[model samples]
Target chain A: MSVTLINLFAVPNGKEDEFVKLWEAIKVDITKQPGFISGKFHKSLKPDSRFNFINVAVWENEEIYWKAFEKSAAPMKEKLHQMGVEMTPALFNVLFEY
Target chain B: MSVTLINLFAVPNGKEDEFVKLWEAIKVDITKQPGFISGKFHKSLKPDSRFNFINVAVWENEEIYWKAFEKSAAPMKEKLHQMGVEMTPALFNVLFEY
Candidate 1:
Protein backbone atom coordinates (compact mmCIF):
# COMPACT_ATOMS: atom_id res chain seq x y z
CA MET A 1 0.00 0.00 0.00
CA SER A 2 1.17 3.50 -0.80
CA VAL A 3 1.21 5.91 2.10
CA THR A 4 -0.05 9.43 1.50
CA LEU A 5 0.39 12.35 3.85
CA ILE A 6 -1.98 15.24 4.45
CA ASN A 7 -0.84 18.32 6.26
CA LEU A 8 -3.37 20.92 7.30
CA PHE A 9 -2.17 24.46 7.83
CA ALA A 10 -3.12 27.92 8.86
CA VAL A 11 -1.49 30.47 6.59
CA PRO A 12 -1.58 33.49 8.91
CA ASN A 13 -4.07 35.76 7.22
CA GLY A 14 -2.41 37.67 4.38
CA LYS A 15 0.64 35.46 4.11
CA GLU A 16 -1.11 32.70 2.16
CA ASP A 17 0.12 33.82 -1.22
CA GLU A 18 3.63 34.20 0.07
CA PHE A 19 3.48 30.69 1.42
CA VAL A 20 2.47 29.36 -1.97
CA LYS A 21 5.16 31.40 -3.68
CA LEU A 22 7.81 30.04 -1.40
CA TRP A 23 6.70 26.49 -2.16
CA GLU A 24 6.85 27.33 -5.84
CA ALA A 25 10.42 28.45 -5.40
CA ILE A 26 11.71 25.17 -4.03
CA LYS A 27 9.50 22.61 -5.77
CA VAL A 28 11.99 21.53 -8.39
CA ASP A 29 14.64 20.53 -5.90
CA ILE A 30 12.14 18.55 -3.84
CA THR A 31 10.90 16.62 -6.84
CA LYS A 32 14.35 15.27 -7.50
CA GLN A 33 14.03 12.71 -4.75
CA PRO A 34 13.63 9.04 -5.55
CA GLY A 35 10.29 7.24 -4.98
CA PHE A 36 8.52 10.56 -5.24
CA ILE A 37 5.47 10.25 -7.41
CA SER A 38 3.86 13.66 -7.27
CA GLY A 39 1.96 15.94 -4.90
CA LYS A 40 -0.56 18.77 -4.82
CA PHE A 41 -1.13 21.80 -2.63
CA HIS A 42 -4.59 23.09 -1.81
CA LYS A 43 -6.12 25.91 0.18
CA SER A 44 -9.58 25.84 1.62
CA LEU A 45 -12.16 27.33 -0.66
CA LYS A 46 -13.59 29.32 2.18
CA PRO A 47 -10.78 31.71 3.03
CA ASP A 48 -12.53 33.14 6.08
CA SER A 49 -11.11 30.43 8.30
CA ARG A 50 -7.56 30.50 9.63
CA PHE A 51 -7.13 26.83 8.73
CA ASN A 52 -6.62 27.61 5.09
CA PHE A 53 -3.88 25.60 3.44
CA ILE A 54 -3.19 21.91 2.82
CA ASN A 55 -0.14 20.08 1.51
CA VAL A 56 -0.25 16.52 0.32
CA ALA A 57 2.51 14.20 -0.94
CA VAL A 58 2.89 10.73 -2.47
CA TRP A 59 6.12 8.82 -1.87
CA GLU A 60 7.51 5.31 -2.24
CA ASN A 61 7.29 4.70 1.50
CA GLU A 62 8.38 5.99 4.88
CA GLU A 63 12.03 5.66 3.94
CA ILE A 64 11.73 7.86 0.89
CA TYR A 65 9.52 10.37 2.65
CA TRP A 66 11.93 10.64 5.56
CA LYS A 67 14.92 11.00 3.27
CA ALA A 68 13.18 13.71 1.29
CA PHE A 69 12.01 15.34 4.47
CA GLU A 70 15.58 15.73 5.66
CA LYS A 71 16.96 17.11 2.44
CA SER A 72 13.90 19.10 1.27
CA ALA A 73 11.23 19.53 3.92
CA ALA A 74 13.51 20.79 6.70
CA PRO A 75 14.52 24.07 5.08
CA MET A 76 11.13 24.62 3.54
CA LYS A 77 9.48 23.92 6.85
CA GLU A 78 11.59 26.61 8.44
CA LYS A 79 10.91 29.07 5.65
CA LEU A 80 7.20 28.41 5.88
CA HIS A 81 7.27 29.03 9.59
CA GLN A 82 9.23 32.22 9.10
CA MET A 83 6.53 33.32 6.70
CA GLY A 84 3.88 32.57 9.36
CA VAL A 85 2.60 29.21 8.24
CA GLU A 86 1.39 26.80 10.90
CA MET A 87 0.35 23.20 10.28
CA THR A 88 0.03 19.68 11.58
CA PRO A 89 1.03 16.74 9.41
CA ALA A 90 -0.26 13.27 10.07
CA LEU A 91 0.70 10.08 8.28
CA PHE A 92 -1.39 7.01 7.45
CA ASN A 93 0.04 3.68 6.42
CA VAL A 94 -2.03 2.01 3.70
CA LEU A 95 -3.84 -0.89 5.23
CA PHE A 96 -6.67 -1.10 2.72
CA GLU A 97 -6.58 -2.59 -0.74
CA TYR A 98 -9.37 -2.38 -3.26
CA MET B 1 6.24 18.54 -9.92
CA SER B 2 4.07 16.23 -7.85
CA VAL B 3 0.42 16.45 -6.97
CA THR B 4 -1.03 15.31 -3.69
CA LEU B 5 -4.75 15.04 -3.17
CA ILE B 6 -6.58 15.49 0.14
CA ASN B 7 -10.18 14.51 0.44
CA LEU B 8 -12.16 15.62 3.46
CA PHE B 9 -15.32 13.74 4.28
CA ALA B 10 -18.23 14.02 6.60
CA VAL B 11 -18.61 10.50 7.87
CA PRO B 12 -22.22 10.09 8.93
CA ASN B 13 -22.36 9.37 12.61
CA GLY B 14 -20.27 6.29 13.44
CA LYS B 15 -19.45 5.49 9.86
CA GLU B 16 -15.95 6.98 10.05
CA ASP B 17 -14.39 3.69 10.92
CA GLU B 18 -16.19 1.94 8.13
CA PHE B 19 -14.96 4.58 5.71
CA VAL B 20 -11.40 4.02 6.77
CA LYS B 21 -11.89 0.29 6.62
CA LEU B 22 -13.17 0.51 3.11
CA TRP B 23 -10.23 2.64 2.03
CA GLU B 24 -7.87 0.14 3.58
CA ALA B 25 -9.58 -2.64 1.71
CA ILE B 26 -8.79 -1.24 -1.71
CA LYS B 27 -5.53 0.62 -1.18
CA VAL B 28 -3.34 -2.10 -2.58
CA ASP B 29 -5.02 -2.28 -5.95
CA ILE B 30 -4.87 1.46 -6.19
CA THR B 31 -1.11 1.54 -5.70
CA LYS B 32 -0.41 -0.51 -8.78
CA GLN B 33 -0.54 2.48 -11.07
CA PRO B 34 2.68 3.21 -12.93
CA GLY B 35 3.42 6.57 -11.37
CA PHE B 36 2.24 5.54 -7.92
CA ILE B 37 4.40 6.36 -4.94
CA SER B 38 2.70 6.03 -1.54
CA GLY B 39 0.01 7.80 0.51
CA LYS B 40 -1.60 8.10 3.95
CA PHE B 41 -5.02 8.92 5.43
CA HIS B 42 -5.83 10.80 8.61
CA LYS B 43 -8.95 11.73 10.52
CA SER B 44 -9.57 14.81 12.58
CA LEU B 45 -8.61 14.57 16.22
CA LYS B 46 -11.79 16.28 17.26
CA PRO B 47 -14.47 13.96 16.06
CA ASP B 48 -17.34 15.98 17.38
CA SER B 49 -18.18 17.20 13.93
CA ARG B 50 -19.48 14.91 11.24
CA PHE B 51 -16.55 16.07 9.14
CA ASN B 52 -14.30 13.50 10.72
CA PHE B 53 -12.38 11.80 7.93
CA ILE B 54 -9.59 12.58 5.51
CA ASN B 55 -8.18 10.64 2.56
CA VAL B 56 -4.86 11.61 1.08
CA ALA B 57 -3.12 10.25 -2.02
CA VAL B 58 0.07 11.10 -3.92
CA TRP B 59 0.35 10.32 -7.58
CA GLU B 60 2.80 10.55 -10.47
CA ASN B 61 0.75 13.27 -12.16
CA GLU B 62 -2.74 14.08 -13.32
CA GLU B 63 -2.41 11.53 -16.09
CA ILE B 64 -1.35 8.68 -13.86
CA TYR B 65 -3.77 9.76 -11.17
CA TRP B 66 -6.65 9.77 -13.58
CA LYS B 67 -5.67 6.37 -14.84
CA ALA B 68 -5.65 4.98 -11.34
CA PHE B 69 -8.92 6.68 -10.66
CA GLU B 70 -10.52 4.95 -13.59
CA LYS B 71 -9.12 1.52 -12.87
CA SER B 72 -9.05 1.48 -9.10
CA ALA B 73 -10.87 4.43 -7.58
CA ALA B 74 -14.23 4.11 -9.29
CA PRO B 75 -15.21 0.96 -7.48
CA MET B 76 -13.66 1.99 -4.18
CA LYS B 77 -15.39 5.32 -4.45
CA GLU B 78 -18.70 3.60 -4.83
CA LYS B 79 -17.97 1.31 -1.92
CA LEU B 80 -16.88 4.21 0.21
CA HIS B 81 -20.12 5.97 -0.59
CA GLN B 82 -22.14 2.88 0.02
CA MET B 83 -20.51 2.77 3.43
CA GLY B 84 -21.54 6.41 3.87
CA VAL B 85 -18.34 8.22 2.98
CA GLU B 86 -18.87 11.72 1.69
CA MET B 87 -15.88 13.83 0.66
CA THR B 88 -14.54 16.58 -1.52
CA PRO B 89 -11.25 15.81 -3.28
CA ALA B 90 -9.47 18.86 -4.58
CA LEU B 91 -6.12 18.73 -6.27
CA PHE B 92 -3.51 21.45 -6.64
CA ASN B 93 -0.82 20.81 -9.16
CA VAL B 94 2.55 21.15 -7.46
CA LEU B 95 3.30 24.84 -7.23
CA PHE B 96 6.00 24.59 -4.60
CA GLU B 97 8.82 22.26 -3.61
CA TYR B 98 11.69 22.62 -1.22
Candidate 2:
Protein backbone atom coordinates (compact mmCIF):
# COMPACT_ATOMS: atom_id res chain seq x y z
CA MET A 1 0.00 0.00 0.00
CA SER A 2 1.11 3.53 -0.66
CA VAL A 3 1.41 5.65 2.47
CA THR A 4 2.01 9.39 2.88
CA LEU A 5 4.07 10.70 5.75
CA ILE A 6 3.59 14.33 6.72
CA ASN A 7 6.69 15.58 8.52
CA LEU A 8 6.10 18.98 10.11
CA PHE A 9 8.73 21.01 11.94
CA ALA A 10 10.45 24.34 12.23
CA VAL A 11 13.90 25.41 11.14
CA PRO A 12 15.17 28.82 12.20
CA ASN A 13 13.44 31.34 9.95
CA GLY A 14 16.58 33.16 8.90
CA LYS A 15 18.35 29.92 8.00
CA GLU A 16 15.80 28.79 5.39
CA ASP A 17 18.29 28.94 2.55
CA GLU A 18 20.93 27.05 4.51
CA PHE A 19 18.40 24.41 5.51
CA VAL A 20 17.58 23.73 1.85
CA LYS A 21 21.26 23.40 1.04
CA LEU A 22 21.65 20.76 3.71
CA TRP A 23 18.48 18.99 2.59
CA GLU A 24 19.61 18.97 -1.04
CA ALA A 25 22.91 17.42 0.04
CA ILE A 26 21.02 14.40 1.37
CA LYS A 27 19.00 13.94 -1.83
CA VAL A 28 21.45 11.47 -3.27
CA ASP A 29 21.19 9.15 -0.28
CA ILE A 30 17.49 9.76 0.13
CA THR A 31 16.76 8.84 -3.48
CA LYS A 32 18.64 5.59 -3.19
CA GLN A 33 16.33 4.27 -0.49
CA PRO A 34 14.29 1.19 -1.37
CA GLY A 35 10.88 2.69 -0.73
CA PHE A 36 11.43 6.33 -1.58
CA ILE A 37 8.59 6.77 -4.00
CA SER A 38 8.27 10.56 -3.80
CA GLY A 39 8.58 13.69 -1.63
CA LYS A 40 7.76 17.41 -1.68
CA PHE A 41 8.71 20.26 0.67
CA HIS A 42 6.45 23.23 1.42
CA LYS A 43 7.20 26.33 3.41
CA SER A 44 4.63 28.42 5.18
CA LEU A 45 4.39 31.40 2.82
CA LYS A 46 3.81 35.11 3.51
CA PRO A 47 2.00 36.40 6.61
CA ASP A 48 2.41 33.02 8.28
CA SER A 49 5.69 32.19 9.94
CA ARG A 50 4.72 30.01 12.84
CA PHE A 51 5.29 26.56 11.34
CA ASN A 52 8.38 26.17 9.22
CA PHE A 53 7.95 23.40 6.71
CA ILE A 54 5.47 20.70 5.93
CA ASN A 55 7.26 17.87 4.14
CA VAL A 56 5.15 15.14 2.64
CA ALA A 57 6.95 11.99 1.61
CA VAL A 58 5.14 9.08 0.01
CA TRP A 59 6.51 5.59 0.52
CA GLU A 60 5.90 2.02 -0.55
CA ASN A 61 5.36 0.83 2.97
CA GLU A 62 5.94 1.69 6.61
CA GLU A 63 8.81 -0.76 7.03
CA ILE A 64 10.81 0.63 4.15
CA TYR A 65 9.93 4.19 5.14
CA TRP A 66 11.33 3.71 8.63
CA LYS A 67 14.56 2.28 7.26
CA ALA A 68 15.05 5.35 5.07
CA PHE A 69 14.23 7.70 7.93
CA GLU A 70 16.59 5.92 10.32
CA LYS A 71 19.50 6.19 7.93
CA SER A 72 18.86 9.62 6.43
CA ALA A 73 17.26 11.80 9.07
CA ALA A 74 19.93 11.67 11.78
CA PRO A 75 22.76 13.28 9.87
CA MET A 76 20.53 15.85 8.21
CA LYS A 77 19.11 16.52 11.67
CA GLU A 78 22.56 17.29 13.01
CA LYS A 79 23.12 19.80 10.24
CA LEU A 80 19.71 21.36 10.87
CA HIS A 81 20.63 21.84 14.50
CA GLN A 82 23.91 23.50 13.52
CA MET A 83 21.82 25.84 11.37
CA GLY A 84 19.60 26.64 14.42
CA VAL A 85 16.35 24.73 14.00
CA GLU A 86 14.42 24.79 17.29
CA MET A 87 11.93 21.94 17.22
CA THR A 88 11.54 18.21 16.75
CA PRO A 89 9.54 16.78 13.84
CA ALA A 90 5.80 16.23 14.07
CA LEU A 91 4.60 13.14 12.18
CA PHE A 92 1.19 12.42 10.67
CA ASN A 93 -0.14 9.42 8.76
CA VAL A 94 -2.19 9.91 5.57
CA LEU A 95 -5.65 8.38 5.61
CA PHE A 96 -7.68 9.46 2.61
CA GLU A 97 -8.48 7.13 -0.29
CA TYR A 98 -11.48 7.17 -2.53
CA MET B 1 0.31 10.21 -12.56
CA SER B 2 -0.27 10.78 -8.84
CA VAL B 3 -0.13 14.39 -7.78
CA THR B 4 -0.19 15.78 -4.26
CA LEU B 5 -1.92 19.11 -3.75
CA ILE B 6 -0.69 21.18 -0.83
CA ASN B 7 -3.39 23.63 0.25
CA LEU B 8 -2.16 26.21 2.72
CA PHE B 9 -4.29 28.97 4.21
CA ALA B 10 -5.19 30.76 7.41
CA VAL B 11 -8.39 30.34 9.41
CA PRO B 12 -9.23 32.20 12.56
CA ASN B 13 -7.22 30.70 15.42
CA GLY B 14 -9.94 29.87 17.89
CA LYS B 15 -12.18 28.14 15.35
CA GLU B 16 -10.16 25.10 14.44
CA ASP B 17 -12.97 22.83 15.57
CA GLU B 18 -15.45 24.65 13.39
CA PHE B 19 -13.15 24.31 10.41
CA VAL B 20 -13.02 20.58 10.86
CA LYS B 21 -16.75 20.40 11.10
CA LEU B 22 -17.09 22.25 7.80
CA TRP B 23 -14.40 20.08 6.21
CA GLU B 24 -16.00 16.84 7.32
CA ALA B 25 -19.38 17.94 6.02
CA ILE B 26 -18.05 18.30 2.51
CA LYS B 27 -15.82 15.20 2.65
CA VAL B 28 -18.69 13.06 1.39
CA ASP B 29 -18.96 14.98 -1.87
CA ILE B 30 -15.21 15.13 -1.96
CA THR B 31 -14.84 11.35 -1.77
CA LYS B 32 -17.17 10.73 -4.67
CA GLN B 33 -15.03 12.51 -7.17
CA PRO B 34 -12.92 10.73 -9.75
CA GLY B 35 -9.15 10.78 -9.27
CA PHE B 36 -9.48 11.49 -5.58
CA ILE B 37 -6.81 9.42 -3.94
CA SER B 38 -5.84 10.80 -0.53
CA GLY B 39 -5.87 13.85 1.75
CA LYS B 40 -4.37 14.74 5.10
CA PHE B 41 -4.53 17.90 7.23
CA HIS B 42 -1.98 19.04 9.81
CA LYS B 43 -1.73 21.91 12.27
CA SER B 44 1.14 23.61 14.06
CA LEU B 45 1.56 21.89 17.41
CA LYS B 46 2.77 24.53 19.86
CA PRO B 47 4.43 27.93 20.10
CA ASP B 48 3.52 28.43 16.44
CA SER B 49 0.30 30.06 15.40
CA ARG B 50 0.96 32.02 12.25
CA PHE B 51 -0.04 29.49 9.63
CA ASN B 52 -3.32 27.83 10.26
CA PHE B 53 -3.11 24.61 8.22
CA ILE B 54 -1.10 22.52 5.84
CA ASN B 55 -3.50 20.25 3.98
CA VAL B 56 -2.10 17.68 1.59
CA ALA B 57 -4.55 16.15 -0.86
CA VAL B 58 -3.49 13.66 -3.54
CA TRP B 59 -5.08 13.03 -6.92
CA GLU B 60 -4.68 10.67 -9.83
CA ASN B 61 -4.35 13.58 -12.25
CA GLU B 62 -4.69 17.34 -12.47
CA GLU B 63 -7.93 17.28 -14.46
CA ILE B 64 -9.92 15.38 -11.90
CA TYR B 65 -8.31 17.27 -9.12
CA TRP B 66 -9.35 20.64 -10.42
CA LYS B 67 -12.87 19.51 -11.11
CA ALA B 68 -13.18 18.17 -7.60
CA PHE B 69 -11.90 21.44 -6.26
CA GLU B 70 -14.44 23.47 -8.21
CA LYS B 71 -17.39 21.35 -7.22
CA SER B 72 -16.50 20.88 -3.59
CA ALA B 73 -14.41 23.80 -2.45
CA ALA B 74 -16.79 26.68 -3.20
CA PRO B 75 -19.40 26.16 -0.51
CA MET B 76 -16.98 24.98 2.14
CA LYS B 77 -15.03 28.07 1.25
CA GLU B 78 -18.04 30.25 1.98
CA LYS B 79 -18.58 28.63 5.34
CA LEU B 80 -14.93 29.24 6.00
CA HIS B 81 -15.31 32.84 4.92
CA GLN B 82 -18.20 33.33 7.31
CA MET B 83 -15.95 32.01 10.04
CA GLY B 84 -13.37 34.74 9.36
CA VAL B 85 -10.58 33.02 7.44
CA GLU B 86 -8.57 35.89 6.02
CA MET B 87 -6.46 34.44 3.26
CA THR B 88 -6.68 32.97 -0.18
CA PRO B 89 -5.65 29.35 -0.64
CA ALA B 90 -2.00 28.91 -1.45
CA LEU B 91 -1.52 26.13 -3.98
CA PHE B 92 1.57 23.97 -4.48
CA ASN B 93 2.10 21.42 -7.20
CA VAL B 94 3.68 18.10 -6.26
CA LEU B 95 6.94 17.48 -8.11
CA PHE B 96 8.32 14.39 -6.46
CA GLU B 97 8.03 10.93 -7.90
CA TYR B 98 10.53 8.13 -7.96
Candidate 3:
Protein backbone atom coordinates (compact mmCIF):
# COMPACT_ATOMS: atom_id res chain seq x y z
CA MET A 1 0.00 0.00 0.00
CA SER A 2 1.07 3.56 -0.60
CA VAL A 3 2.24 5.57 2.39
CA THR A 4 1.88 9.21 3.33
CA LEU A 5 4.88 10.99 4.81
CA ILE A 6 4.43 14.04 7.05
CA ASN A 7 7.68 15.72 7.95
CA LEU A 8 7.63 18.47 10.53
CA PHE A 9 10.41 21.03 10.38
CA ALA A 10 11.72 23.72 12.68
CA VAL A 11 13.87 26.39 11.09
CA PRO A 12 15.84 29.06 12.86
CA ASN A 13 14.07 32.38 13.33
CA GLY A 14 14.49 34.87 10.43
CA LYS A 15 15.87 32.13 8.18
CA GLU A 16 12.68 31.42 6.27
CA ASP A 17 13.91 32.71 2.94
CA GLU A 18 17.16 30.78 3.08
CA PHE A 19 15.36 27.64 4.17
CA VAL A 20 12.90 27.93 1.31
CA LYS A 21 15.73 28.21 -1.20
CA LEU A 22 17.40 25.06 0.06
CA TRP A 23 14.06 23.28 0.12
CA GLU A 24 13.35 24.26 -3.48
CA ALA A 25 16.52 22.51 -4.55
CA ILE A 26 15.81 19.47 -2.38
CA LYS A 27 12.20 19.25 -3.56
CA VAL A 28 13.26 19.22 -7.19
CA ASP A 29 15.64 16.32 -6.63
CA ILE A 30 13.40 14.29 -4.35
CA THR A 31 10.32 14.37 -6.57
CA LYS A 32 12.30 12.77 -9.40
CA GLN A 33 12.84 9.59 -7.41
CA PRO A 34 10.95 6.37 -8.11
CA GLY A 35 7.59 5.91 -6.31
CA PHE A 36 7.24 9.59 -5.44
CA ILE A 37 3.60 10.26 -6.13
CA SER A 38 2.94 13.84 -5.07
CA GLY A 39 4.08 16.29 -2.44
CA LYS A 40 3.91 19.84 -1.12
CA PHE A 41 5.72 22.11 1.32
CA HIS A 42 3.74 24.17 3.79
CA LYS A 43 4.55 27.09 6.06
CA SER A 44 2.69 27.56 9.29
CA LEU A 45 -0.03 30.18 9.36
CA LYS A 46 1.03 31.21 12.84
CA PRO A 47 4.30 33.00 12.18
CA ASP A 48 5.56 32.56 15.73
CA SER A 49 5.07 28.81 15.89
CA ARG A 50 8.23 26.78 16.59
CA PHE A 51 7.43 23.93 14.21
CA ASN A 52 6.81 26.15 11.24
CA PHE A 53 7.13 24.00 8.18
CA ILE A 54 5.65 20.73 7.03
CA ASN A 55 6.40 18.49 4.07
CA VAL A 56 3.64 16.17 2.98
CA ALA A 57 4.20 13.49 0.37
CA VAL A 58 2.72 10.27 -0.91
CA TRP A 59 4.95 7.36 -1.98
CA GLU A 60 4.25 3.91 -3.31
CA ASN A 61 5.31 2.43 0.04
CA GLU A 62 7.67 2.89 2.96
CA GLU A 63 10.65 1.14 1.38
CA ILE A 64 10.69 3.18 -1.81
CA TYR A 65 10.20 6.36 0.16
CA TRP A 66 13.27 5.71 2.30
CA LYS A 67 15.26 4.48 -0.71
CA ALA A 68 14.56 7.70 -2.54
CA PHE A 69 15.41 9.75 0.52
CA GLU A 70 18.73 7.97 1.10
CA LYS A 71 19.72 7.75 -2.56
CA SER A 72 18.75 11.15 -3.92
CA ALA A 73 17.95 13.42 -0.98
CA ALA A 74 20.53 12.54 1.66
CA PRO A 75 22.97 15.27 0.70
CA MET A 76 20.29 17.89 0.77
CA LYS A 77 19.03 16.47 4.00
CA GLU A 78 22.52 16.84 5.39
CA LYS A 79 22.64 20.39 4.08
CA LEU A 80 19.41 21.08 5.95
CA HIS A 81 20.89 19.60 9.10
CA GLN A 82 23.99 21.76 8.70
CA MET A 83 21.68 24.75 8.44
CA GLY A 84 20.12 23.79 11.77
CA VAL A 85 16.73 22.69 10.48
CA GLU A 86 15.19 20.11 12.78
CA MET A 87 13.04 17.48 11.06
CA THR A 88 10.70 14.82 12.42
CA PRO A 89 9.03 12.47 9.94
CA ALA A 90 6.09 10.13 10.39
CA LEU A 91 4.60 7.74 7.85
CA PHE A 92 1.04 6.51 7.51
CA ASN A 93 -1.22 4.46 5.27
CA VAL A 94 -4.27 6.26 3.94
CA LEU A 95 -7.33 4.74 5.50
CA PHE A 96 -10.09 6.53 3.58
CA GLU A 97 -10.82 9.42 1.21
CA TYR A 98 -13.74 11.32 -0.20
CA MET B 1 -4.91 32.54 0.80
CA SER B 2 -5.61 28.86 1.08
CA VAL B 3 -4.63 27.08 4.26
CA THR B 4 -3.63 23.49 4.92
CA LEU B 5 -4.77 21.86 8.14
CA ILE B 6 -3.09 18.83 9.62
CA ASN B 7 -4.96 17.32 12.53
CA LEU B 8 -3.00 14.67 14.36
CA PHE B 9 -5.06 12.03 16.10
CA ALA B 10 -4.26 9.43 18.73
CA VAL B 11 -6.73 6.56 18.83
CA PRO B 12 -6.78 3.91 21.51
CA ASN B 13 -5.52 0.42 20.80
CA GLY B 14 -7.72 -1.94 18.75
CA LYS B 15 -10.23 0.86 18.13
CA GLU B 16 -9.17 1.54 14.57
CA ASP B 17 -12.42 0.35 13.03
CA GLU B 18 -14.56 2.42 15.37
CA PHE B 19 -12.46 5.49 14.84
CA VAL B 20 -12.68 5.12 11.09
CA LYS B 21 -16.44 4.95 11.29
CA LEU B 22 -16.66 8.20 13.24
CA TRP B 23 -14.25 9.79 10.80
CA GLU B 24 -16.35 8.70 7.84
CA ALA B 25 -19.30 10.54 9.25
CA ILE B 26 -17.14 13.53 10.02
CA LYS B 27 -15.57 13.61 6.57
CA VAL B 28 -18.95 13.55 4.95
CA ASP B 29 -20.36 16.48 6.89
CA ILE B 30 -17.25 18.56 6.95
CA THR B 31 -16.57 18.35 3.22
CA LYS B 32 -20.03 19.61 2.47
CA GLN B 33 -19.43 22.85 4.32
CA PRO B 34 -18.35 26.03 2.60
CA GLY B 35 -14.56 26.63 2.40
CA PHE B 36 -13.88 22.94 2.81
CA ILE B 37 -11.45 22.25 0.02
CA SER B 38 -10.43 18.60 0.45
CA GLY B 39 -9.15 16.08 2.99
CA LYS B 40 -7.98 12.54 3.63
CA PHE B 41 -7.77 10.30 6.70
CA HIS B 42 -4.59 8.35 7.26
CA LYS B 43 -3.80 5.49 9.60
CA SER B 44 -0.31 4.94 10.89
CA LEU B 45 1.70 2.13 9.33
CA LYS B 46 2.93 0.98 12.72
CA PRO B 47 -0.05 -0.27 14.67
CA ASP B 48 1.74 -0.01 18.00
CA SER B 49 2.57 3.65 17.69
CA ARG B 50 1.02 6.10 20.15
CA PHE B 51 -0.25 8.48 17.49
CA ASN B 52 -1.99 6.30 14.91
CA PHE B 53 -4.11 8.59 12.73
CA ILE B 54 -3.95 11.92 10.95
CA ASN B 55 -6.41 14.09 9.05
CA VAL B 56 -4.94 16.27 6.35
CA ALA B 57 -7.14 18.96 4.81
CA VAL B 58 -7.15 22.11 2.73
CA TRP B 59 -9.37 25.10 3.36
CA GLU B 60 -9.86 28.52 1.88
CA ASN B 61 -8.33 30.07 5.01
CA GLU B 62 -8.32 29.90 8.77
CA GLU B 63 -11.60 31.75 9.30
CA ILE B 64 -13.69 29.63 6.97
CA TYR B 65 -12.17 26.43 8.27
CA TRP B 66 -13.20 27.14 11.83
CA LYS B 67 -16.60 28.27 10.65
CA ALA B 68 -17.15 25.04 8.80
CA PHE B 69 -15.91 22.88 11.60
CA GLU B 70 -18.06 24.62 14.17
CA LYS B 71 -21.13 24.70 12.00
CA SER B 72 -21.05 21.14 10.75
CA ALA B 73 -18.49 19.04 12.55
CA ALA B 74 -18.77 20.04 16.20
CA PRO B 75 -21.06 17.24 17.21
CA MET B 76 -18.90 14.62 15.59
CA LYS B 77 -15.90 16.20 17.18
CA GLU B 78 -17.58 15.86 20.52
CA LYS B 79 -18.35 12.24 19.78
CA LEU B 80 -14.71 11.66 19.00
CA HIS B 81 -13.82 13.39 22.23
CA GLN B 82 -16.16 11.14 24.13
CA MET B 83 -14.53 8.13 22.52
CA GLY B 84 -11.17 9.25 23.88
CA VAL B 85 -9.56 10.30 20.61
CA GLU B 86 -7.02 13.01 21.13
CA MET B 87 -6.70 15.68 18.40
CA THR B 88 -4.13 18.36 17.76
CA PRO B 89 -4.47 20.72 14.81
CA ALA B 90 -2.00 22.92 13.03
CA LEU B 91 -2.68 25.33 10.19
CA PHE B 92 -0.41 26.26 7.32
CA ASN B 93 -0.16 28.06 4.02
CA VAL B 94 1.10 26.23 0.93
CA LEU B 95 4.64 27.41 0.40
CA PHE B 96 5.65 25.52 -2.75
CA GLU B 97 4.92 22.59 -5.00
CA TYR B 98 6.86 20.30 -7.33
Q: Per-prediction TM-score, please?
A: 0.55, 0.56, 0.86
Q: Pick the candidate with the highest DockQ.
A: 3
Runs with alpha carbons beyond 4 Å of true place in candidate 3: none
Q: In model 3 chain B, which range of ten residues has the least summed lDDT?
A: B42-51
Instruction: For residues B1-98, write the lDDT of model 1, one tens digit per residue.
Output: 46666676777877766776676666667666788776665655456543466766677777777777778767767777777667667654444443
Predicted complexes: DockQ each: 0.14, 0.21, 0.73
Query: Residue B82 deviation, candidate 2, in Å?
Result: 15
Candidate 2 per-residue C-alpha lDDT over B44-66 given as tens digits, one digit per residue, 9 for 90 to 100: 44324454555677778767777
Alpha-carbon runs more than 4 Å astray in model 1? A94-98, B1-53, B56-98
Write down the lDDT that model 3 would get.
0.83
Interface RMSD of each: 6.2, 5.0, 1.3
Candidate 1 at B32: error in angstroms? 25
lDDT (tens digit, per residue) of candidate 3 on B28-96: 788788898888888888876556887889898889998886787667778878888887678988887
Regions more than 4 Å wrong, model 2? A87-91, B1-22, B28-54, B57-98
What digit string (tens of lDDT, one per residue) describes model 1 on residues A1-98?
Answer: 45566677778878877877776766677678887877766765456544577766767777777787888778888887788787777555444322
In angstroms, how far off is A42's CA in candidate 2?
A: 1.4
Q: For model 3, what TM-score is found for chain B? A: 0.89
